[model samples]
Target: MNYKTTKILWKTFVWIVLIIGTIITLVPLFWMLSTALKSNAEVMQFDMVWWPEDPKWSNFVEAFTTLPFGEWTMNTIFITVFTIIGTLLSCTVVAYGFARFNVRGNKTLFIILLSTMMLPSTVTMIPQFVIFRELDWINTFYPLIVPSFFGNATFIFLLRQFFMTIPTELEDAAKMDGLGTMGILGRIILPMTLPALTTVAIFQFNGAWNDFMGPLIYLSDPDDFTLALGINFFKGENNQVQWNYLMSASVISMLPSLLIFFFGQKYFIQGINLSSGIKG
Candidate 1:
Protein backbone atom coordinates (compact mmCIF):
# COMPACT_ATOMS: atom_id res chain seq x y z
CA MET A 1 0.00 0.00 0.00
CA ASN A 2 1.04 3.62 -0.61
CA TYR A 3 2.03 5.91 2.31
CA LYS A 4 -1.19 7.95 2.05
CA THR A 5 -3.34 4.79 2.05
CA THR A 6 -1.48 3.45 5.15
CA LYS A 7 -2.08 6.75 6.98
CA ILE A 8 -5.77 6.64 6.12
CA LEU A 9 -6.03 3.03 7.33
CA TRP A 10 -4.30 3.90 10.65
CA LYS A 11 -6.64 6.86 11.20
CA THR A 12 -9.66 4.64 10.52
CA PHE A 13 -8.46 2.09 13.08
CA VAL A 14 -7.90 4.77 15.72
CA TRP A 15 -11.35 6.25 15.14
CA ILE A 16 -12.95 2.79 15.38
CA VAL A 17 -11.19 2.09 18.71
CA LEU A 18 -12.25 5.45 20.12
CA ILE A 19 -15.85 4.85 19.08
CA ILE A 20 -15.89 1.44 20.78
CA GLY A 21 -14.41 2.86 23.98
CA THR A 22 -17.00 5.64 24.06
CA ILE A 23 -19.83 3.14 23.67
CA ILE A 24 -18.44 0.95 26.48
CA THR A 25 -18.16 3.88 28.87
CA LEU A 26 -21.58 5.26 27.95
CA VAL A 27 -23.51 2.00 28.25
CA PRO A 28 -23.41 1.86 32.04
CA LEU A 29 -24.39 5.51 32.41
CA PHE A 30 -27.27 5.04 29.95
CA TRP A 31 -28.48 1.95 31.80
CA MET A 32 -28.29 3.71 35.16
CA LEU A 33 -30.47 6.56 33.90
CA SER A 34 -32.90 4.12 32.37
CA THR A 35 -33.06 2.11 35.60
CA ALA A 36 -33.57 5.24 37.67
CA LEU A 37 -36.69 5.99 35.62
CA LYS A 38 -37.91 2.38 35.44
CA SER A 39 -40.92 0.97 37.28
CA ASN A 40 -40.38 -2.14 39.40
CA ALA A 41 -42.07 -4.40 36.86
CA GLU A 42 -40.08 -3.03 33.96
CA VAL A 43 -36.77 -3.41 35.80
CA MET A 44 -37.46 -7.09 36.47
CA GLN A 45 -38.14 -7.81 32.80
CA PHE A 46 -35.91 -10.65 31.49
CA ASP A 47 -34.60 -8.61 28.58
CA MET A 48 -32.73 -5.38 29.05
CA VAL A 49 -34.33 -2.19 27.76
CA TRP A 50 -32.24 0.81 26.73
CA TRP A 51 -34.92 3.25 27.87
CA PRO A 52 -37.99 2.97 30.02
CA GLU A 53 -41.44 2.98 28.37
CA ASP A 54 -42.76 5.11 31.25
CA PRO A 55 -40.22 7.56 32.60
CA LYS A 56 -40.81 7.93 36.31
CA TRP A 57 -39.52 11.34 37.25
CA SER A 58 -40.97 10.59 40.65
CA ASN A 59 -38.26 8.01 41.39
CA PHE A 60 -36.13 10.87 42.64
CA VAL A 61 -39.01 12.05 44.79
CA GLU A 62 -39.52 8.54 46.10
CA ALA A 63 -35.80 8.34 46.90
CA PHE A 64 -36.06 11.50 48.96
CA THR A 65 -39.20 10.31 50.78
CA THR A 66 -37.80 6.90 51.63
CA LEU A 67 -34.39 8.04 52.94
CA PRO A 68 -33.01 10.96 54.91
CA PHE A 69 -31.69 12.12 51.57
CA GLY A 70 -32.28 15.79 52.31
CA GLU A 71 -30.34 15.53 55.55
CA TRP A 72 -27.59 13.57 53.82
CA THR A 73 -27.44 16.20 51.09
CA MET A 74 -26.95 18.97 53.63
CA ASN A 75 -24.37 17.00 55.60
CA THR A 76 -22.45 16.15 52.41
CA ILE A 77 -22.45 19.76 51.21
CA PHE A 78 -21.13 20.94 54.53
CA ILE A 79 -18.30 18.39 54.59
CA THR A 80 -17.38 18.95 50.93
CA VAL A 81 -17.15 22.72 51.39
CA PHE A 82 -14.92 22.46 54.41
CA THR A 83 -12.77 19.82 52.75
CA ILE A 84 -12.23 22.05 49.71
CA ILE A 85 -11.49 25.12 51.80
CA GLY A 86 -9.05 23.34 54.09
CA THR A 87 -7.24 21.68 51.19
CA LEU A 88 -6.92 24.92 49.22
CA LEU A 89 -5.69 26.98 52.17
CA SER A 90 -3.13 24.49 53.40
CA CYS A 91 -1.93 23.10 50.09
CA THR A 92 -1.48 26.50 48.43
CA VAL A 93 0.67 27.89 51.23
CA VAL A 94 2.77 24.76 51.69
CA ALA A 95 3.24 24.44 47.95
CA TYR A 96 4.25 28.11 47.62
CA GLY A 97 6.83 27.59 50.33
CA PHE A 98 8.23 24.48 48.67
CA ALA A 99 8.36 26.06 45.23
CA ARG A 100 9.48 29.63 46.04
CA PHE A 101 10.92 29.66 49.57
CA ASN A 102 13.06 26.60 49.96
CA VAL A 103 14.86 26.17 53.29
CA ARG A 104 17.43 23.80 54.77
CA GLY A 105 16.06 20.22 54.83
CA ASN A 106 13.18 21.34 52.64
CA LYS A 107 14.29 19.06 49.83
CA THR A 108 14.64 16.07 52.15
CA LEU A 109 11.30 16.80 53.79
CA PHE A 110 9.57 17.01 50.42
CA ILE A 111 11.09 13.71 49.37
CA ILE A 112 9.80 12.10 52.57
CA LEU A 113 6.40 13.65 51.95
CA LEU A 114 6.27 12.32 48.40
CA SER A 115 7.36 8.90 49.65
CA THR A 116 4.26 8.73 51.85
CA MET A 117 2.13 8.45 48.73
CA MET A 118 3.70 5.13 47.83
CA LEU A 119 2.38 3.48 50.98
CA PRO A 120 -1.22 2.34 50.77
CA SER A 121 -3.71 3.92 53.15
CA THR A 122 -4.70 0.49 54.45
CA VAL A 123 -1.29 0.23 56.10
CA THR A 124 -2.09 3.20 58.34
CA MET A 125 -5.85 2.93 58.72
CA ILE A 126 -5.79 1.02 61.98
CA PRO A 127 -3.13 3.20 63.58
CA GLN A 128 -4.98 6.31 62.43
CA PHE A 129 -8.22 4.94 63.87
CA VAL A 130 -6.51 4.22 67.17
CA ILE A 131 -5.03 7.72 67.35
CA PHE A 132 -8.37 9.28 66.60
CA ARG A 133 -10.00 7.05 69.18
CA GLU A 134 -7.45 8.24 71.76
CA LEU A 135 -8.30 11.81 70.86
CA ASP A 136 -12.00 11.04 71.32
CA TRP A 137 -12.66 12.06 67.71
CA ILE A 138 -13.31 8.64 66.20
CA ASN A 139 -17.01 9.04 65.60
CA THR A 140 -17.04 12.63 64.42
CA PHE A 141 -16.51 14.66 61.25
CA TYR A 142 -13.04 15.52 62.59
CA PRO A 143 -11.62 12.39 61.05
CA LEU A 144 -12.83 13.56 57.66
CA ILE A 145 -12.04 17.28 57.90
CA VAL A 146 -9.10 17.77 60.25
CA PRO A 147 -6.39 15.93 58.29
CA SER A 148 -7.42 17.82 55.16
CA PHE A 149 -6.44 21.09 56.86
CA PHE A 150 -2.84 19.83 57.08
CA GLY A 151 -2.63 19.45 53.29
CA ASN A 152 -2.49 16.34 51.09
CA ALA A 153 0.72 15.07 49.54
CA THR A 154 -0.75 14.83 46.05
CA PHE A 155 -2.30 18.30 46.14
CA ILE A 156 0.88 19.85 47.50
CA PHE A 157 2.97 18.18 44.79
CA LEU A 158 0.57 19.24 42.05
CA LEU A 159 0.37 22.82 43.29
CA ARG A 160 4.12 23.00 43.74
CA GLN A 161 4.66 21.79 40.17
CA PHE A 162 2.37 24.51 38.87
CA PHE A 163 3.92 27.15 41.12
CA MET A 164 7.40 26.34 39.79
CA THR A 165 6.27 27.28 36.26
CA ILE A 166 5.73 30.89 37.39
CA PRO A 167 8.55 33.39 36.77
CA THR A 168 10.69 34.49 39.73
CA GLU A 169 10.99 37.95 38.11
CA LEU A 170 7.42 38.60 39.24
CA GLU A 171 8.44 37.84 42.82
CA ASP A 172 11.40 40.25 42.59
CA ALA A 173 9.15 42.86 40.97
CA ALA A 174 6.62 42.52 43.78
CA LYS A 175 9.40 42.80 46.37
CA MET A 176 10.63 46.01 44.76
CA ASP A 177 7.12 47.38 45.13
CA GLY A 178 7.35 46.65 48.91
CA LEU A 179 5.05 43.60 48.83
CA GLY A 180 5.96 40.75 51.15
CA THR A 181 5.38 37.05 50.53
CA MET A 182 1.71 37.03 51.44
CA GLY A 183 1.14 40.26 49.61
CA ILE A 184 2.69 38.92 46.41
CA LEU A 185 0.83 35.61 46.67
CA GLY A 186 -2.45 37.28 47.44
CA ARG A 187 -2.25 40.11 44.90
CA ILE A 188 -0.27 38.59 42.05
CA ILE A 189 0.50 34.85 42.22
CA LEU A 190 -2.80 33.64 43.62
CA PRO A 191 -4.72 35.15 40.74
CA MET A 192 -2.59 33.30 38.22
CA THR A 193 -2.81 30.12 40.31
CA LEU A 194 -6.55 29.80 39.80
CA PRO A 195 -6.26 26.87 37.40
CA ALA A 196 -4.05 24.86 39.77
CA LEU A 197 -6.15 25.86 42.78
CA THR A 198 -9.34 24.91 41.00
CA THR A 199 -7.85 21.56 40.06
CA VAL A 200 -6.95 20.85 43.70
CA ALA A 201 -10.37 22.00 44.92
CA ILE A 202 -12.09 19.78 42.37
CA PHE A 203 -10.08 16.73 43.46
CA GLN A 204 -10.56 17.31 47.18
CA PHE A 205 -14.22 18.18 46.74
CA ASN A 206 -14.84 15.03 44.74
CA GLY A 207 -12.91 12.90 47.25
CA ALA A 208 -14.86 14.28 50.21
CA TRP A 209 -18.11 14.24 48.24
CA ASN A 210 -17.86 10.54 47.39
CA ASP A 211 -16.30 9.45 50.68
CA PHE A 212 -17.92 6.29 51.99
CA MET A 213 -15.32 4.24 53.87
CA GLY A 214 -14.24 7.08 56.15
CA PRO A 215 -17.79 8.00 57.06
CA LEU A 216 -18.69 4.36 57.61
CA ILE A 217 -15.78 4.00 60.00
CA TYR A 218 -16.10 7.30 61.89
CA LEU A 219 -19.84 8.08 61.81
CA SER A 220 -21.85 6.11 64.36
CA ASP A 221 -25.18 7.82 63.96
CA PRO A 222 -27.30 7.69 60.83
CA ASP A 223 -27.73 11.44 61.13
CA ASP A 224 -23.98 11.94 60.76
CA PHE A 225 -23.69 9.79 57.64
CA THR A 226 -22.32 11.22 54.38
CA LEU A 227 -24.38 10.72 51.23
CA ALA A 228 -22.38 7.68 50.14
CA LEU A 229 -23.21 5.76 53.30
CA GLY A 230 -26.66 7.37 53.61
CA ILE A 231 -27.68 6.18 50.15
CA ASN A 232 -26.77 2.64 51.09
CA PHE A 233 -29.60 2.78 53.66
CA PHE A 234 -31.91 1.71 50.85
CA LYS A 235 -30.84 -1.87 51.43
CA GLY A 236 -33.02 -3.70 53.97
CA GLU A 237 -33.45 -7.11 55.69
CA ASN A 238 -32.67 -10.38 53.84
CA ASN A 239 -30.24 -8.33 51.75
CA GLN A 240 -33.05 -7.05 49.56
CA VAL A 241 -32.23 -3.87 47.69
CA GLN A 242 -34.51 -1.11 46.39
CA TRP A 243 -33.42 -0.92 42.78
CA ASN A 244 -35.20 2.20 41.52
CA TYR A 245 -34.47 4.36 44.57
CA LEU A 246 -30.87 3.11 44.71
CA MET A 247 -30.28 3.98 41.07
CA SER A 248 -32.00 7.33 41.63
CA ALA A 249 -29.75 8.15 44.55
CA SER A 250 -26.66 7.06 42.57
CA VAL A 251 -27.71 9.35 39.73
CA ILE A 252 -28.18 12.25 42.14
CA SER A 253 -24.81 11.58 43.75
CA MET A 254 -23.09 12.23 40.42
CA LEU A 255 -24.47 15.77 39.95
CA PRO A 256 -22.05 17.89 42.02
CA SER A 257 -18.90 16.50 40.35
CA LEU A 258 -20.64 16.79 36.98
CA LEU A 259 -21.63 20.41 37.56
CA ILE A 260 -18.16 21.27 38.85
CA PHE A 261 -16.32 19.80 35.84
CA PHE A 262 -18.86 21.31 33.43
CA PHE A 263 -18.47 24.87 34.63
CA GLY A 264 -14.73 24.61 35.39
CA GLN A 265 -13.71 23.07 32.07
CA LYS A 266 -11.69 26.10 31.02
CA TYR A 267 -9.69 26.27 34.23
CA PHE A 268 -9.36 22.49 34.31
CA ILE A 269 -7.80 22.52 30.86
CA GLN A 270 -5.50 25.32 31.90
CA GLY A 271 -4.35 23.30 34.88
CA ILE A 272 -3.39 20.45 32.58
CA ASN A 273 -1.49 22.68 30.15
CA LEU A 274 1.61 23.11 32.33
CA SER A 275 2.34 19.38 32.50
CA SER A 276 0.85 18.51 29.11
CA GLY A 277 3.55 20.09 26.92
CA ILE A 278 5.88 17.65 25.19
CA LYS A 279 9.43 18.59 24.08
CA GLY A 280 10.86 17.33 20.79
Candidate 2:
Protein backbone atom coordinates (compact mmCIF):
# COMPACT_ATOMS: atom_id res chain seq x y z
CA MET A 1 0.00 0.00 0.00
CA ASN A 2 1.00 3.62 -0.49
CA TYR A 3 2.11 5.51 2.66
CA LYS A 4 -1.07 7.63 2.98
CA THR A 5 -3.36 4.67 2.39
CA THR A 6 -1.45 2.53 4.93
CA LYS A 7 -1.67 5.29 7.58
CA ILE A 8 -5.42 5.69 7.03
CA LEU A 9 -5.93 1.93 7.41
CA TRP A 10 -3.95 1.86 10.65
CA LYS A 11 -5.94 4.74 12.10
CA THR A 12 -9.21 3.01 11.16
CA PHE A 13 -8.13 -0.17 12.96
CA VAL A 14 -7.11 1.75 16.10
CA TRP A 15 -10.44 3.59 16.27
CA ILE A 16 -12.45 0.38 15.82
CA VAL A 17 -10.51 -1.35 18.60
CA LEU A 18 -10.88 1.62 20.97
CA ILE A 19 -14.64 1.84 20.44
CA ILE A 20 -15.03 -1.88 21.12
CA GLY A 21 -12.87 -1.70 24.22
CA THR A 22 -14.76 1.30 25.56
CA ILE A 23 -18.07 -0.52 25.26
CA ILE A 24 -16.65 -3.61 26.98
CA THR A 25 -15.34 -1.56 29.91
CA LEU A 26 -18.46 0.60 30.28
CA VAL A 27 -20.88 -2.36 30.26
CA PRO A 28 -20.41 -3.21 33.93
CA LEU A 29 -20.59 0.44 34.98
CA PHE A 30 -23.87 0.81 33.08
CA TRP A 31 -25.16 -2.33 34.74
CA MET A 32 -24.19 -0.97 38.16
CA LEU A 33 -26.12 2.23 37.56
CA SER A 34 -29.08 0.24 36.25
CA THR A 35 -29.00 -1.98 39.29
CA ALA A 36 -28.73 0.97 41.65
CA LEU A 37 -31.90 2.50 40.24
CA LYS A 38 -33.77 -0.83 40.44
CA SER A 39 -36.05 -1.83 43.30
CA ASN A 40 -35.49 -5.13 45.04
CA ALA A 41 -38.43 -6.73 43.18
CA GLU A 42 -37.33 -5.31 39.82
CA VAL A 43 -33.81 -6.53 40.48
CA MET A 44 -35.04 -10.07 41.14
CA GLN A 45 -37.37 -10.16 38.10
CA PHE A 46 -36.75 -12.96 35.65
CA ASP A 47 -37.04 -10.54 32.77
CA MET A 48 -34.09 -8.21 33.19
CA VAL A 49 -34.73 -4.51 32.82
CA TRP A 50 -31.90 -2.90 30.81
CA TRP A 51 -32.82 0.25 32.70
CA PRO A 52 -35.00 0.63 35.77
CA GLU A 53 -38.73 0.42 35.08
CA ASP A 54 -39.36 3.06 37.77
CA PRO A 55 -36.00 4.35 38.84
CA LYS A 56 -35.80 4.56 42.64
CA TRP A 57 -33.43 7.46 43.15
CA SER A 58 -34.21 7.27 46.87
CA ASN A 59 -32.04 4.20 47.20
CA PHE A 60 -29.00 6.44 47.36
CA VAL A 61 -30.62 8.46 50.09
CA GLU A 62 -31.64 5.29 51.91
CA ALA A 63 -28.11 3.93 51.54
CA PHE A 64 -26.72 6.97 53.27
CA THR A 65 -29.33 7.11 56.04
CA THR A 66 -29.10 3.43 56.84
CA LEU A 67 -25.53 3.82 58.04
CA PRO A 68 -23.29 6.56 59.42
CA PHE A 69 -22.24 7.28 55.88
CA GLY A 70 -21.21 10.89 56.52
CA GLU A 71 -18.77 9.80 59.19
CA TRP A 72 -17.53 6.93 57.09
CA THR A 73 -17.01 9.25 54.14
CA MET A 74 -15.09 11.69 56.29
CA ASN A 75 -12.88 8.92 57.57
CA THR A 76 -12.21 7.66 54.07
CA ILE A 77 -11.40 11.17 52.86
CA PHE A 78 -9.01 11.75 55.75
CA ILE A 79 -7.18 8.53 55.00
CA THR A 80 -7.10 9.15 51.26
CA VAL A 81 -5.76 12.70 51.55
CA PHE A 82 -3.09 11.87 54.11
CA THR A 83 -2.03 8.77 52.19
CA ILE A 84 -1.62 10.74 48.97
CA ILE A 85 0.35 13.52 50.67
CA GLY A 86 2.51 11.10 52.61
CA THR A 87 3.28 8.92 49.61
CA LEU A 88 4.19 11.92 47.44
CA LEU A 89 6.51 13.59 49.96
CA SER A 90 8.21 10.47 51.29
CA CYS A 91 8.41 8.54 48.00
CA THR A 92 9.78 11.50 46.01
CA VAL A 93 12.43 12.27 48.62
CA VAL A 94 13.55 8.62 48.88
CA ALA A 95 13.54 8.23 45.10
CA TYR A 96 15.54 11.45 44.69
CA GLY A 97 18.13 10.21 47.17
CA PHE A 98 18.42 6.87 45.42
CA ALA A 99 18.53 8.37 41.93
CA ARG A 100 20.86 11.36 42.60
CA PHE A 101 23.20 10.48 45.45
CA ASN A 102 25.72 7.73 46.09
CA VAL A 103 25.82 6.92 49.80
CA ARG A 104 27.75 4.08 51.43
CA GLY A 105 25.68 0.84 51.44
CA ASN A 106 22.98 2.50 49.33
CA LYS A 107 22.82 -0.43 46.93
CA THR A 108 22.44 -2.95 49.74
CA LEU A 109 19.78 -0.83 51.40
CA PHE A 110 17.86 -0.52 48.14
CA ILE A 111 18.00 -4.27 47.64
CA ILE A 112 16.56 -4.77 51.10
CA LEU A 113 13.79 -2.29 50.33
CA LEU A 114 12.94 -4.13 47.09
CA SER A 115 13.02 -7.43 48.96
CA THR A 116 10.29 -6.18 51.31
CA MET A 117 8.08 -5.66 48.26
CA MET A 118 8.46 -9.32 47.35
CA LEU A 119 7.40 -10.46 50.81
CA PRO A 120 3.67 -11.04 51.04
CA SER A 121 1.91 -8.53 53.32
CA THR A 122 -0.04 -11.43 54.82
CA VAL A 123 3.15 -12.72 56.41
CA THR A 124 3.68 -9.47 58.30
CA MET A 125 0.04 -8.78 59.14
CA ILE A 126 0.03 -10.40 62.58
CA PRO A 127 3.29 -8.88 63.72
CA GLN A 128 2.20 -5.47 62.45
CA PHE A 129 -1.11 -5.78 64.29
CA VAL A 130 0.64 -6.65 67.51
CA ILE A 131 2.94 -3.68 67.22
CA PHE A 132 0.05 -1.33 66.51
CA ARG A 133 -1.95 -2.76 69.40
CA GLU A 134 0.98 -2.19 71.74
CA LEU A 135 1.18 1.41 70.58
CA ASP A 136 -2.59 1.81 71.25
CA TRP A 137 -3.16 2.63 67.59
CA ILE A 138 -6.02 0.19 67.04
CA ASN A 139 -9.49 1.67 66.54
CA THR A 140 -7.77 4.78 65.16
CA PHE A 141 -6.65 6.00 61.71
CA TYR A 142 -2.97 5.74 62.55
CA PRO A 143 -2.36 2.20 61.34
CA LEU A 144 -3.94 2.99 57.98
CA ILE A 145 -2.40 6.40 57.29
CA VAL A 146 0.96 6.33 59.06
CA PRO A 147 2.64 3.69 56.90
CA SER A 148 2.38 5.79 53.74
CA PHE A 149 4.56 8.49 55.30
CA PHE A 150 7.53 6.09 55.16
CA GLY A 151 6.92 5.54 51.42
CA ASN A 152 6.05 2.48 49.31
CA ALA A 153 8.89 0.48 47.79
CA THR A 154 7.24 -0.12 44.41
CA PHE A 155 6.33 3.56 44.02
CA ILE A 156 9.81 4.59 45.16
CA PHE A 157 11.34 2.36 42.53
CA LEU A 158 9.04 3.76 39.85
CA LEU A 159 9.81 7.38 40.79
CA ARG A 160 13.54 6.61 41.00
CA GLN A 161 13.52 5.29 37.45
CA PHE A 162 11.86 8.47 36.23
CA PHE A 163 14.29 10.68 38.20
CA MET A 164 17.30 8.92 36.72
CA THR A 165 16.09 9.80 33.21
CA ILE A 166 16.41 13.54 33.98
CA PRO A 167 19.67 15.03 32.58
CA THR A 168 22.35 15.77 35.20
CA GLU A 169 23.18 19.02 33.38
CA LEU A 170 20.07 20.59 34.84
CA GLU A 171 21.27 19.93 38.40
CA ASP A 172 24.80 21.11 37.50
CA ALA A 173 23.47 24.42 36.25
CA ALA A 174 21.38 24.84 39.39
CA LYS A 175 24.45 24.14 41.55
CA MET A 176 26.56 26.77 39.71
CA ASP A 177 23.87 29.33 40.65
CA GLY A 178 24.55 28.52 44.36
CA LEU A 179 21.39 26.40 44.65
CA GLY A 180 21.48 23.74 47.36
CA THR A 181 20.14 20.21 46.96
CA MET A 182 16.73 21.12 48.36
CA GLY A 183 16.58 24.19 46.10
CA ILE A 184 17.38 22.14 43.02
CA LEU A 185 14.75 19.56 43.97
CA GLY A 186 12.15 22.16 44.80
CA ARG A 187 12.74 24.52 41.87
CA ILE A 188 13.79 22.17 39.07
CA ILE A 189 13.53 18.39 39.65
CA LEU A 190 10.03 18.47 41.10
CA PRO A 191 8.55 20.69 38.41
CA MET A 192 10.12 18.50 35.73
CA THR A 193 8.71 15.33 37.35
CA LEU A 194 5.14 16.56 37.82
CA PRO A 195 3.88 13.65 35.75
CA ALA A 196 5.43 11.04 38.06
CA LEU A 197 4.14 12.85 41.17
CA THR A 198 0.63 12.96 39.79
CA THR A 199 0.80 9.29 38.89
CA VAL A 200 1.95 8.31 42.39
CA ALA A 201 -0.73 10.48 44.00
CA ILE A 202 -3.42 8.82 41.90
CA PHE A 203 -2.23 5.32 42.77
CA GLN A 204 -1.98 6.09 46.49
CA PHE A 205 -5.46 7.63 46.53
CA ASN A 206 -6.95 4.60 44.83
CA GLY A 207 -5.17 2.19 47.15
CA ALA A 208 -6.36 4.00 50.27
CA TRP A 209 -9.89 4.35 48.92
CA ASN A 210 -10.32 0.69 48.02
CA ASP A 211 -8.61 -0.79 51.04
CA PHE A 212 -10.96 -3.05 53.06
CA MET A 213 -8.75 -5.56 54.86
CA GLY A 214 -6.56 -3.04 56.65
CA PRO A 215 -9.51 -1.11 57.98
CA LEU A 216 -11.36 -4.28 58.91
CA ILE A 217 -8.44 -5.42 61.03
CA TYR A 218 -7.41 -2.12 62.56
CA LEU A 219 -10.66 -0.25 63.14
CA SER A 220 -12.87 -1.66 65.89
CA ASP A 221 -15.57 1.01 65.96
CA PRO A 222 -18.10 2.18 63.39
CA ASP A 223 -17.03 5.78 64.05
CA ASP A 224 -13.57 5.03 62.73
CA PHE A 225 -14.70 2.84 59.80
CA THR A 226 -13.87 3.84 56.22
CA LEU A 227 -16.23 3.54 53.26
CA ALA A 228 -14.85 0.16 52.25
CA LEU A 229 -15.46 -1.24 55.71
CA GLY A 230 -18.89 0.33 55.89
CA ILE A 231 -19.96 -1.66 52.82
CA ASN A 232 -19.94 -4.83 54.92
CA PHE A 233 -22.74 -3.46 57.08
CA PHE A 234 -25.16 -4.07 54.20
CA LYS A 235 -24.92 -7.79 54.91
CA GLY A 236 -26.97 -9.54 57.56
CA GLU A 237 -26.11 -12.33 59.98
CA ASN A 238 -28.58 -14.46 57.98
CA ASN A 239 -26.43 -13.82 54.87
CA GLN A 240 -29.18 -11.74 53.24
CA VAL A 241 -27.13 -9.25 51.29
CA GLN A 242 -28.35 -5.82 50.21
CA TRP A 243 -27.04 -6.09 46.69
CA ASN A 244 -28.59 -2.86 45.40
CA TYR A 245 -27.33 -0.74 48.26
CA LEU A 246 -23.90 -2.34 48.07
CA MET A 247 -23.72 -1.64 44.37
CA SER A 248 -24.83 1.96 44.88
CA ALA A 249 -22.30 2.54 47.60
CA SER A 250 -19.59 0.97 45.46
CA VAL A 251 -20.48 3.21 42.51
CA ILE A 252 -20.34 6.29 44.70
CA SER A 253 -17.02 5.18 46.21
CA MET A 254 -15.42 4.81 42.78
CA LEU A 255 -16.10 8.42 41.73
CA PRO A 256 -13.00 10.13 43.24
CA SER A 257 -10.50 7.84 41.54
CA LEU A 258 -12.40 8.07 38.26
CA LEU A 259 -12.40 11.86 38.50
CA ILE A 260 -8.67 11.92 39.30
CA PHE A 261 -7.90 9.71 36.31
CA PHE A 262 -10.18 11.75 34.06
CA PHE A 263 -8.55 15.06 34.95
CA GLY A 264 -4.91 13.92 35.35
CA GLN A 265 -4.93 11.35 32.56
CA LYS A 266 -2.28 13.11 30.48
CA TYR A 267 0.16 13.21 33.36
CA PHE A 268 -0.61 9.57 34.21
CA ILE A 269 0.26 8.37 30.70
CA GLN A 270 3.40 10.50 30.60
CA GLY A 271 4.49 9.18 33.99
CA ILE A 272 4.00 5.59 32.89
CA ASN A 273 6.04 6.13 29.74
CA LEU A 274 8.85 7.98 31.53
CA SER A 275 9.01 5.53 34.44
CA SER A 276 9.25 2.67 31.94
CA GLY A 277 12.58 4.19 30.78
CA ILE A 278 11.24 5.25 27.38
CA LYS A 279 12.56 8.56 25.99
CA GLY A 280 9.49 10.15 24.54
Against the reference, the lDDT scores of all candidates come to 0.89, 0.92
**Tens digit per residue, CA lDDT, model 1, 31-78:** 898999999888888998779988999999999888788898899999
lDDT string for model 2 (1-280, tens) is 8999999999999999999999999999999998988899887889978898689888888888899988999999999999999999999999999999998988998999999999899999999999999999998899998999999999999999999999999999999999999999999999999999999988888899999999999998889899999989998779988878888888888888899999999999999999998766
- Cα lDDT of candidate 2 equals 0.92
User: Which regions of candidate 1 are displaced past 4 Å?
Assistant: 275-280
**lDDT score of residue 223 within candidate 2:** 90
The predictions' CA RMSDs to the true structure, in order, are 1.7, 2.1
Q: Cα lDDT for residue 146, model 1?
A: 89
Query: For residue 66, what is the lDDT in candidate 1?
Result: 86
Top lDDT prediction, candidate number: 2
TM-score of model 2 vs. true structure: 0.92
